[model samples]
Target chain A: MARSTLYQQVASELRRAIYSGDLGPGDQLPTEADLMTSYGVSRNTVRLALGELVNEGLISRTPRRGSIVRDRRPLLMYPQRELTPQPASVPREAFGFAVSQEGREPSQVIEVSIVEPPEDIAIRLELPDGGLAVVRRRLRFVDGQPYNTNDSFFPHALVRDSEIVRPGDILRGANRVLEELGHPQVRVVDDISARMPTPAESSRLELEPGTPVVEYVRVGYDSDDVPVRVAVSVLPADKHLIRYELERR
Target chain B: MARSTLYQQVASELRRAIYSGDLGPGDQLPTEADLMTSYGVSRNTVRLALGELVNEGLISRTPRRGSIVRDRRPLLMYPQRELTPQPASVPREAFGFAVSQEGREPSQVIEVSIVEPPEDIAIRLELPDGGLAVVRRRLRFVDGQPYNTNDSFFPHALVRDSEIVRPGDILRGANRVLEELGHPQVRVVDDISARMPTPAESSRLELEPGTPVVEYVRVGYDSDDVPVRVAVSVLPADKHLIRYELERR
Candidate 1:
């Protein structure tokens, strides 16, 4: 076999082990020297194989620790659930609800400010030229690990006196505040796309190389069909799965 | 300013031109010599700036045409439309309908076969351990350009005698054939994730380097809640956008 094929063979075996649960999350693989001795290949081949696994987001390599299998269990997000009426017992937002369902702690750091929104956000919100917006930016975490980011924008004129302009968590969620303002969202349109992370996103999310992110944008409209809010979520592809269940109506 | 900042400045200017429609699809960018002289930067810096645009899927580089802006307008996909009833004038599938709505030609090359599916697919289909499946694989195109790939799998026992087992296109779509077989899909669960494309997918889809793909899997169930079909679509992220509209019920 060609030398390239040899490295690929090693990678495939290790990938299989990870998928089969033989090598689990946080479980370290054999050291380079041990792998070389067992597979009868050079250290270069072992490194190449491990590199492949890292690029696939199946494993991570650190200077102190050898290659360790990563946690591949993704959080399932039900986008449709956002519009559903949540029980009063569940007071948190959709992200927190999903994480707590998985028995993980959820937290976030948020900053609220008013500024001229970006062109894309302006377009989605149907803002006129030079229209201002109040943006609530959040860096969310699950179990103390940064998971994703959500930045929601609302028309400044509409939410100037609302709780959304405050710099803190909305225990009842911003959607509820919108309802109290007499502009409850009756419908929403979600757009999903994916791409490689920008440098800023990579550092903020601590993503490994070759990791992509899903950019989900949802624009909520009130009863009068006026766009009220635009929420953009950047989810690490390896850590989240967006799901939608539809029934024929 | 640092050298890195200089290149980024150049990249930002070019990006603005593209987004602002000053540089359109198939429009050739300034040559390396011209860029170097205009920006008063080294040829190496010019290459780096152009490389960034290529990675962003905004431009393509070729030996003959140099660098040209790519067509970045994505096709809007409405997943909910599949479950909604279509008019008699629209005889094609959801994908074909969406493309034609944009005034673009839609076409596909299909291959049909029966085989043991991959483990993940089997689990989704709830197939017996040794059960077989009939797969209708399609390489779809828009305006004669390679766009995406969709592979729909049905339980072999259910579609063995159906048109899904034949080797040509289903003019009316495979979903209708399923309905005729007394297994109309009443509900569906869609799972959306993103990742770097495998070498095989890269070649088959003709994707650019640094481009990721949205892996969309939809499991359709009959009235009895038994999964009747599983469709997997590999969409190049730059070329497609999946949208969902939800109403509060």
Candidate 2:
């Protein structure tokens, strides 16, 4: 076995300190100079050690903030567990962008007011056929790059009549709008598949032939197990990483 | 709204059929001619629909065989509650690779050997300090591309001197070997994180600058939470998709 690097040893020591509660979350680790003096390592070595810690998601370092421990704390919930969507005291903003998306994007090219969801979505939402539902389709881009196209279905009775569902800002994030409407998502079930991108999908996503694109069908439900929205997103391969954090129950 | 192509409608219908169990897993779907006749669509349209099904992991098509239904079953067992490192009939071959990797074709590399685990892993494995463990590192490749890497740590004493421990053909995967050795996995806990890849990692994985990687730390254990192996996988953004089938409990 290769001898453990000096930086690795430093990283392990710091990690142990954090996990042992000697360094609490939000606490700052010693500065480079202090670490250098304490560990008799160079500035570069200290930086490398700190970098490893940050990469492990154990700490976050900023120019002004130095190196403070990160919360590495996310709520652990099962993917199969029912999550209730309720209003949040504070709205959370999560960014979605393709690597190649290079400018202002998430454009809304087409918008149509619909009275009902298609049979498939209606069945998933458990809504009656012809029931009022808003069907919105948007060709989303990030940084001027065409990335994904979203076709989102929401029950008209849920938000169709609200201003949040209107034309001008319908181009914004639908999830953000949904949160403001008192249906903060507590759970999201995403069913994903992949295949060669279609000509249209490929062109929109700027994918090459045979390049796989991941397709996700996301269902958002209320605490009552009532499906609120069914959304579809397609991402080009080489651009996105879908993540899910599972906690031991 | 523009009328969707007939092939899309057919594809969606077929998907719904499978999801609803109208077409059971491993059950062959109707032939393209039958589908064309049933939907009153062209052979091309039916072929397109079937192609989409294959991409979505819903069906498999082979020579002299029609599109056979796939086991679109959800392996959504909770990380907190699922049995692991145990004697079971579940074969590792059931899980197919999203991307093809074979031979020594420009893929990531992982070395297998025996070593001591970190304190946390040692404690979980019910071993004292300096306890022996089998360590395996795998470099992942996608279409001849270097993409990700994994390092798995197993109880060395438990697996040492075994064919599965010396980097040879693991007749069965790690757990299967453990079971044959009279230790079965009962549960597994996973820690997941996301961060920017390191310079070495970025270069080795052929990741573009500024690309982030997702890290997964999984510890498979026996019924008593005795950790058998702890695996750490670093997946690049460009080559992988992680999916979860959520069920409301």
Candidate 3:
């Protein structure tokens, strides 16, 4: 049981304030000079304390705004919903439906292309050697802010004549399209891990410097146990939370 | 698309090598001077290129060893197994079984105590105001290395006389003990999120500088729908991967 350092003590106090709701999202933290005076520490110590909060993704600092508490209301995502059958009346995809349920607008820009898929995705989709795939890459947004990215890959031979190869949004959802094509997914496997965002991902998601991203990959299998679709999602850690419910059988 | 910088070009080449298996785990990367000569870049450019890989968790730098490709073979965790019933002969917990199946030794140090539970845990366990809980805090290890931490909290009134209150490993697991006490959990909800580790967590897990951690919380409810147990696991992102399989009904 070693004692915490001076900077850590200072950081702990501010962290407590944020967690206790004394300071909330969009609330400005005390300036460096004020923090120095209150903590009776040098400016360097105060800056170090603030840096800890930044790394924790609790607050963001700007030249003009100084330090402001960040929004921590992450969107809840249920991966099971995408595998389960949706009612006919609810045609939206899982992401859009989840977002709208929270009273937020969901939108995405899609780019459809046919190409040689990445090796990992090709294996997940069970593509043959040199086999191509149709990929629908989407930059999804909520409330006009870039939230995440979802890229779904399908064997080109199976989707060559389908709407999945077209360059636009599918309002009825791609899962339905797969069902209509007689390749309905009866099972899905999801793999999740987290890591720091790449430079490109940082720019695309407008992520904070220290923010990490969750890499969620789902491979859908048809009733015949053939892999059909592989969907990869890059979710900004600060803005997404994944949930699952299981019942003992 | 804008052109990538000189350093990014160098980094991408090395990244391709790693992903393509041209460079494998524990393989030493080219020396700084060698990279500078091959890429025809300055020392600063080479250092920046290596820094990208480090931030991506693809490599680790050391004063004596320079840089080496990290071991990316993450332990696959199946959260569903914990809820499923096992055979009479298999008494090990899900983690222990999984680790053994992978031919890795699993071990843990446990500390049991009774205390006022955290606010969130109290709500999850549906405990009344001022209700106490018996917490079994475990620092789990794999191959004699600190891997993760699992802290399970139970209502003190429910497990006061049970072995869960004892400070030692439970060979049959605490869940089995709960079942014997007529509190078999039939349903569970799991929430998964990730963030930078706290200082204490970083030291406990012996994580690298840029590593993140996954915070997984599972609340279990008995057949009566009474919440009985809440288990919180902090898994270092680099060492663990979570997987789930869903079948459509």
Tens-place lDDT per residue, model 2, A95-197, is 3222212122234364747666655566555565358778777675554556567677888888876654576444235666766788755455565544456
DockQ of each: 0.30, 0.12, 0.29
Error of 3 at A55 (Å): 21
Candidate 1: residue pairs that collide: none
**Candidate 1 lDDT over residue span A1-249, tens digit each:** 112457678987887676566788999999999999988998767776776566455688887998898887576788887888779887877778777765567899999999999766775676766899999999999878899999999999999998999899998789888988999988998989999999999999999999999999898999987889999999999998888988987
Q: Report the C-alpha lDDT of model 2 over B74-141, residue by residue, as the tens digit.
A: 22112332332223443431111112111112334548877677544554455653678778878755
TM-scores for candidates 1 onward, in order: 0.75, 0.47, 0.75
lDDT tens digits, residue span B29-127, model 3: 999999999989998778767875774567888879998999864677899988888787998877787777656689999999999996667756767
| Candidate 1 residue spans exceeding 4 A from truth | A1-70, B1-70
CA lDDT, candidate 2, residue A160: 70
**How high is the lDDT of residue B35 in model 2?**
91
